[model samples]
Target: MSSKKSDSEKITIVIVGGGIGGLALLNALSTSIDPEKHTVVLVDARPSHMHLISALRLVVSDADDLLNKAVHPYGNHTFRNKFAGNGSFVHGSVTSVKFGDDGKGGELILDNGEIVAYDVLVLATGSSWPRPLGFPTESRSAIEEHIMARRAEFSAAKDILLVGGGSLGLELAGELKDIFPSKPVSIIHRERLLLNDTYPDKYRIAVQKAVEDRGVTVLLGDAITASNSSDVSTSQVPEGGFVTEQGKKLNPDLVVPTWGNRPNTSYLPSDLLSSTGHVKILPTFQLPAYPNVFAFGDIIDWKEQKGAAKAAFFHTPKVAKNVMVYLDLSERASTCDLMASRRSAKYTGCMEMIMITNGKSRGLGYFNILWGIIVGSWLITLLKAKTLMIGRIPSQTGFTPK
Candidate 1:
């Protein structure tokens, strides 16, 4: 097949973006057809998402799953053995895609400056965020450098300013105060609540008390206008939000923006995607517009919540199986439609997300069921640490995590 041709030929499916959903899709692809039955290439727009996911993870599970879902661009042999046993990973971004242009059907215009032919395309590029608000760095070296800088800032500063009041600010302040005990760490939020007022009101109030009890100062409804943009990225528009109706500086030693994540699909066209920014798919998890294409995980804005509590590989086994079935035989659904079961959904955002602070021993978990809540368990913390220390992707496809 050449770069562009307009007719149906032997299906060569090319998956773009190797994040959690992408990897699961690829892993699903691994067992779907024979080794060489379909041509496949997993494309990552960035060099990797390891640091990006890990930093956000500290605020989420802060545990074993981060490394399991991370990607190694340079190609670690052990990591390769663990994850990419059969899949061929290519390092390049899809600059443009031409449909039905190639003899086979379509082809991806990659940044490496090559034409990648495919009959079907699946995109699962997740979103991105910034420091303290999101992952701190892109690579291991950058993270190490950041750790050194933060440690220096920790040692020298009398006051540490936590700029945002979301989970990042809450977790960082609580952990830092716990570690230093006497050092002043103040958390500032532009609004009144710590977490949004959406959950049980008691949840936010209790968390605020817990954070305050840790000796972290909480300042709410205060806006910080920068003295100036001393350092701003050239490509980025004077990107900032604190110069309020009246100018004032709620100067904290640091300012981090954590609320800048949406479904990551800018690389994809607007038509194939739904308003929520995830790819629109039919009930079977196959792209109705493009049946051969399949997607799930963070990219599918389904009835399930994006977090692991709901869409864990264990919960959506049938969605995965259904995709497999549809791929092998046309228009056939799997025996079980687990995706349609929501009455006993048992998976919701209220499901506990075990968020650990920098203090390894201490943690917080948001649980839907009261019985599932626990904190400061050394055994559980130890298990999480071990898994992240060595990257371990879960073998299961999609299930609600218990």
Candidate 2:
């Protein structure tokens, strides 16, 4: 990174949402993009990056330091030093983008009434999960308060019911059981299997068995009626608890819904969005109408399931390469040449891969490659069950894990 280039002479690359994808792209650009030619700016609504991968563990466990470990502040000296003279982190929420007629470059209008100009833009404003998994606040203290409140709720509950049997529901059940051994935790999945049909039945069965082995009840093939399910924000069961479609009434002290993650694309234009609210992008991760604008992470309409690992490991490098190529060709290349470069660098898709942890010592998962290899307890514990990859955040952000 160099301080020699004047601001006017450099290309400003603005990225929205400093979640896994945005941070990964920032790290990539920090290492490879020319500092003298390009100035990078990452804007996030939150004060720090909440490692949502380990969120369940943080809230469920009694450990006080886990919350501190789960949050990685963008303004921290370590992160600031990483981007020293080249890039900067902005704290704001984007309300809308004012793109030119050609959709080449645009100014982003922030909710706080600030405008950020960009020569190239990247949207990675990830999805929002249910409570305990999602942070609705922006300030660090408010976020901590939210976590502490959820922790208190879990502590006071006589029994907990996890309302969807996705990865989040399973992981939350596991964490609760691991922390409070006798705390009656149950998972009620609408589907017959633990997960969706993305993986084979064997893997789903293995997950359910692992969860059941931990003494957590696994109720499948039944769903709570809409009348019993509360607002989307809380998704709590009513006073008498919820009655499943199969006529089983569960009266748990706490009900947490783990399904229904909406992409943070409300601020984006409808033209750039799919019917499902995800940004429509070409294989190169660039918007079809706005070539200079790119998107990835859970916010993009990629066929594959969204995960932090996918964004950090796969999408980051591809998007970074394409952005660099676009920058390099902006000065001299013809439209055909630019399109050719983008077409040559592309991400076709990724296979279905998921790992579910059951308590700290047990779990099950499968990778679709090699025809869906089922990973057992030991590998799951070693990989994710114990720490939930909390250390990866610091490493990815150029800091040593404590």
Candidate 3:
């Protein structure tokens, strides 16, 4: 593909996927650089940006008050009021990217046959989870309905079985128990420990204890396989419970699948992707062969645990600086080894930090790399449960926080 003729002298930066990383990068570039020199365009398939972490909490809760707060439209919120007229939002899905011969610039072909050219490209499409847990939907009402349906299922069920012992599954179990204390809730994890072996032993043990203390049954070290049982009706609450590889049977009225997130990179070239389907980025958050092309958040091949906080607080700032350096070099024609000099220092895999809450009250938090200290329910509630940071989304999108 060849570069298109430009009407203006300004360089164009096209960022795909308006997730946390993309929004942060847009914010950083908009605030740091002069609008006259650069034009920014954000492309996303969804009409609104969904605060997924907060959505998780909302799905399990009985209150419907926070549904509108969890989703924000990009046109009216992120790129509408901000950007100072230098940025535009495209509501479409990119089918593929065609790079220029120089590898510094490219044109993105959207599914709707629209082609957008860019001097620089950023991939922050992130990942997708299963429906009723995490999935892409443009309709806010659809998501609210799904949550309400799931809530009804949870309430009507006599026993609830949550598949996967990861943080999400555990949190769901805790929330279910807290909301419906009389119902029997159990978490079936394949691993022997909660949250797998990635975290420290102390934190795992503490989390297991905290979850079990909430009256949630913790079943570990068993691989669960779902099978249709003749004894259960097709329209039953659970459909059917899973049986362990060890021949253990668990029958619950409701079964919620809550793990595994597939990276969203179908539009990217195969050569630019890792074996696991994630975009391959260097330490500077740039594509290995194409420095002008950057990626971060859950879509990049970073080893750290993926979360909104990690992307917003850590990865986006580094990517912003790298993009700035690239733009500076292009403008000045200087021969500075910007990537070499500004590569992000290797991130030492430190102690894992996470706050898992049952509801608005009980929870568990783990912090401190040197000392694995487990925080009580009150601290977790204070940190996340009370708000789930839903109140911060408006300000995060450049609007006044309500």
Candidate 4:
């Protein structure tokens, strides 16, 4: 618990989670820190980093090779070769983190009972949603089976009800309409506006109009409640259309929940968490209780919409630089000022940019910082829906495309 590593020893930086923020941090560290001084470890429960946005289309289309396309193996030869002696990837879920005395880093307790000690810790575990929307399985075959089963359900159902009018709900509704236009697709969102409140009114209206134009029924400002019982499972398909809080009833053959993401920070210390269970980080992206313990992405309590692109672009570099400062301090302990280094590595928030697509063809994009510019379907399709930025992940992580 002394939280000290000798200068001769390589500083171990354990990054818990291999999602966008974690992997980006690994890539950034690979360039910033010298291998002789530091060794980085990328840890995750999954064997591959999933392109979740790509999986949305796959769920609707039932693409046979989507598993291959959407998931990129962390054990890729090119990615491994780039890190070489500098870093390595570990496949295991972190069950708990045992912090060292003060804010000087600690040990990661893996679910498999293995312990990983770290000089610096980066928690980028991100957030989780209901399955089929998000792949919960680590194995490729398991994910394939999950998707196929969902596809079968979609195929058989005549009426589908998607709860929540957020981007995911709208996108899934649109995809269902595109694939099975004959089926009745409806979205029941508690909010009158589409998307979240973070977005401007014009942007939300544009998305609502676009989704409605796709022939999908939009039910706004009504919360879905079970008519008889409050014990309705979040993932359960309703027996009959559930009533709203105001006594309106809706019946759908299949109900897919598409809102709210819980942060994957159950293993984090309670003091570091917000009331909502997300990790609380300073503007420098470091936890107050543990400055050497940096966190970002959806897991952090940043008041903004969470997205993979945003995590990769904004959070990763700031974390990598701060970690490097710690490493450098460990090396030149006599000279470097830790306080100055932490202050210099401040992370001012990023601009609000979002692209929500309705399946393959149409969607809306908004860059609020850029004078509230709105992008149309063609731009959205070209930028995201067509590929879901799958290629970009591999490129950023230094993995050759399969």
Q: Which stretches of candidate 3 lie over 4 Å from their true place?
A: 1-9, 62-64, 80-82, 226-240, 334-351, 399-402
Off by over 4 Å in 2: 1-3, 76-82, 231-236, 337-339, 399-402
Candidate 4 per-residue lDDT over residues 1-402, each given as its tens digit = 754444437677888888777777777776666655566788888777776677777887755366666677776442343356556677788888888875565889988888888888888888877655667545767766777888888898888877778777877887887789778988878887877788889889888888878788888888776443332334455565577786887777777877757898888768778999988887778777676788889998888888887888888877777777666655665324556454457777888898888877787899986577999989999998777777676665566655
Q: What global local distance difference test value does model 4 have? A: 0.75
In candidate 1, stretches whose alpha carbon ends up further than 4 angstroms from where it belongs are: 1-11, 47-86, 99-105, 132-158, 174-182, 221-249, 274-276, 303-305, 308-319, 330-358, 370-402
Candidate 3 global TM-score: 0.88
Q: RMSD, each candidate, Å? A: 7.7, 2.5, 4.3, 3.7
TM-score of each: 0.67, 0.93, 0.88, 0.91
Expressed as tens digits, the lDDT of each residue in 257-374 for candidate 3 is: 7665778899888998889899887877878777678888888887777777677878888788878777877777652665446644333333457888776787788775666677
Model 2 worst lDDT run, 10 consecutive residues: 75-84
TM-score winner between 1 and 2, please give it. Answer: 2
Which ranking of candidates, highest TM-score first? 2, 4, 3, 1
Against the true structure, candidate 1 reaches a TM-score of 0.67
Computed on alpha carbons, the lDDT of every model, listed in order, comes to 0.51, 0.81, 0.74, 0.75
